[model samples]
Target: MTQAFEGIRIVDFSQVLAGPFASGQLAMLGADVIKVEQPGVGDQMRTTMANNKLADLKLSPGFMGVNANKRAITVDLKHPDAKEIIHRLLADADVLLENFKAGVIKRLGYDYDAVRAVKPDIIYCSVSGYGQQGPMAGKAAYDGAIQAVSGMMGITGTPESGPMRAGYMPADISTGITAAFAISSALFRRTHTGEGQHLDVSMLDSAMTIMSPNLNKYLATREEPALVGNTSPTFQGTANTWPTKDGHMQVSVITDRMTATLVQALGKPEWADDPRFTTSQGRVEHADEVKALIGDVLAAETTAHWIERLGNEGIPTAPVNSLKQLMEFPQLEHRGILATVPAPPGVEGELTMTGAGFHASNGEPKVTSAGPRLGQHTEEVLAELGYDAAAIQAFRDNDVI
Candidate 1:
């Protein structure tokens, strides 16, 4: 069966995580994505996390993760010839994705209007720190900066540690997801109307959107929410990572029935009778005492012991797995969530990419090709746009490819 986006062609000018990740999802759904890069040096991520100091900067695991299933082509957009080449490619393209700062694309002469002049139905997406018309549009922002600006950092750490950036780049990842959804929606709209529109996605906006409940509560009460660490505010002390005999286990007892069951499992059912622990609100009020009591009981059992017992009792509990543990997880294997893909040539490693999140009865998502080597498809892609052999050679010789 044909993949979802079989005939779609995407001109991807996105460099780092957010834009590339969004395009990667499209590629997985069978869009033909050509990643545009600068000549000599490709994406900045190609050197961001090089393993060995003296090694060539072209090999980066960070680059490999988000850039899978796309082709790469080098182009010096600063050069007149290269600009002409990009316009020629855009003539038949379905989508154009970029992650430059606000106004940068317009400055480069490849804004939505410029692209629309060439391809009237081209879906143009711009991913930025803020957005196109905001007061902070031109302000520089990386993942950490966005986290601070979005109140994500404020709610991250424990009360004792002040504000802290999350362990991972939540802003970048969240924005990537948002961009993918927006692009997919745009593609669907294009199917109906045969018209394309510009999409402006903001990392700060995406991050703040994820924190709506907390922000809304603060607005209503005129009080800022304190950092609650691993516990969620709505769960009211019902969710947390507790210490087991072997390691830590995360447990969520959202309802009173589950809480009572957990108390019985720990041979402390009397705790459920306590007025301070009777209701969810009361539990939240005396969360520290209730947590200490639960901790004392959980510390007596090993993680494996509790896992089996909890599973049998219908309590939602799991070991807090590391990446290594997760890779070897039995359930993930059974569910076919992970699969190995060949690494790029000369990379000396293979990568484990995830399959689609959910199975489809109608059709399977395709992985057409692995991530392209820098500018690997320059000649092939340009040729598809009707560039003859001599013209392609001239473009390459001029360092305009």
Candidate 2:
């Protein structure tokens, strides 16, 4: 079966996380993505967090994570011959994804207007921190900065610990997912309108949208969310993390039925008849008392024991898994969300990387190859642009590609 983006081609000029992640999603679904990078330096992420050996090979685990299923080419956009080459590539391209700071792409002469001049129906997507035209446009931002500014950190930790960013790159990952959705939507719209789109995806905007539940509460009630730490927004004593004999386990006994099940699981069915623990509101009023009771009971049992006992009772429960534990999770082996691809050059065997979040009936997301080495397909891509061998060599000598 044909994939969703089987015939689509993208010129991806994004790096680091957000832009590359967006394009990577399309590539996984069969878009022909050509990742354009500098001649030698390549993407900053290629070596950002890599160790000495991986950095020397320009194959950082972080880079390999998002760049699978794409080709790589080098180009000096500042070089005079660059325009001709880019025009050739754009002539048949359906999408252009970039994450440069606002005005940077324009300064390099590949703004939407110039690109539109070449491919009138091209989907131009620009991913940035604050957006294309704003008071904070062009300002430098990273995941941590976005988290702090987006109020994500403010509501994350306990009041004692103050604000804290999430352990993962929520802002960058959310922005990438948002951009991918926006680009896909644009493609869908173009089918009927036959007009291209300019997508301005902002990490800040995406973060705000992701926090709509908290933001909407503030908007309606004019109240700020408190730092609750591992506490559920429902404020129910039964919906919080507790220490077990072996480890930490989180539970969400939201509804009365679930709470009853939880109490039964704890061998405390008598609590169900108590007035202070009968209803959801009653539980909230006696949160501390109820929490202490649950904690005392849970602390006597092993995490694995409760997982099985409470899980069988229909209570939402999970153990806080470390990275090692998560990687070895048995359920993940069946999910197919992790793809095993051939190792990049100099590596042996296979490398396991993440793919799409969900599965499909057909044309499921996959990684055909590991992320490309820097400029690994420069000659091939240039040759496809109608550049002869000698012309390609000349561009290399001139540092134009």
TM-score per prediction, in order, is: 0.95, 0.98
Question: Quick one: best TM-score, which candidate?
Answer: 2
How does residue 27 of candidate 1 score in lDDT? 80
lDDT (tens digit, per residue) of candidate 1 on 1-401: 67788888999998878898888877877888889999988998877766773127374767766777888899998888888889888977999999988888888899999899889998999999998886999777889999998988888878898899988878988898899899999989988999999999999999988888888988899887788877767546657888899899988886777888887877887877986567888778888787888888889989999889887999998898988888877889577655568877766556776655666565566454456678888898888889999999999899998
**Predicted candidate 2: what Cα RMSD to the true structure?**
1.0
* Model 2 TM-score, all chains together: 0.98
**Model 1 TM-score relative to the real fold:** 0.95
Q: Considering summed lDDT, which 10 consecutive residues are worst modelled in model 1? A: 53-62
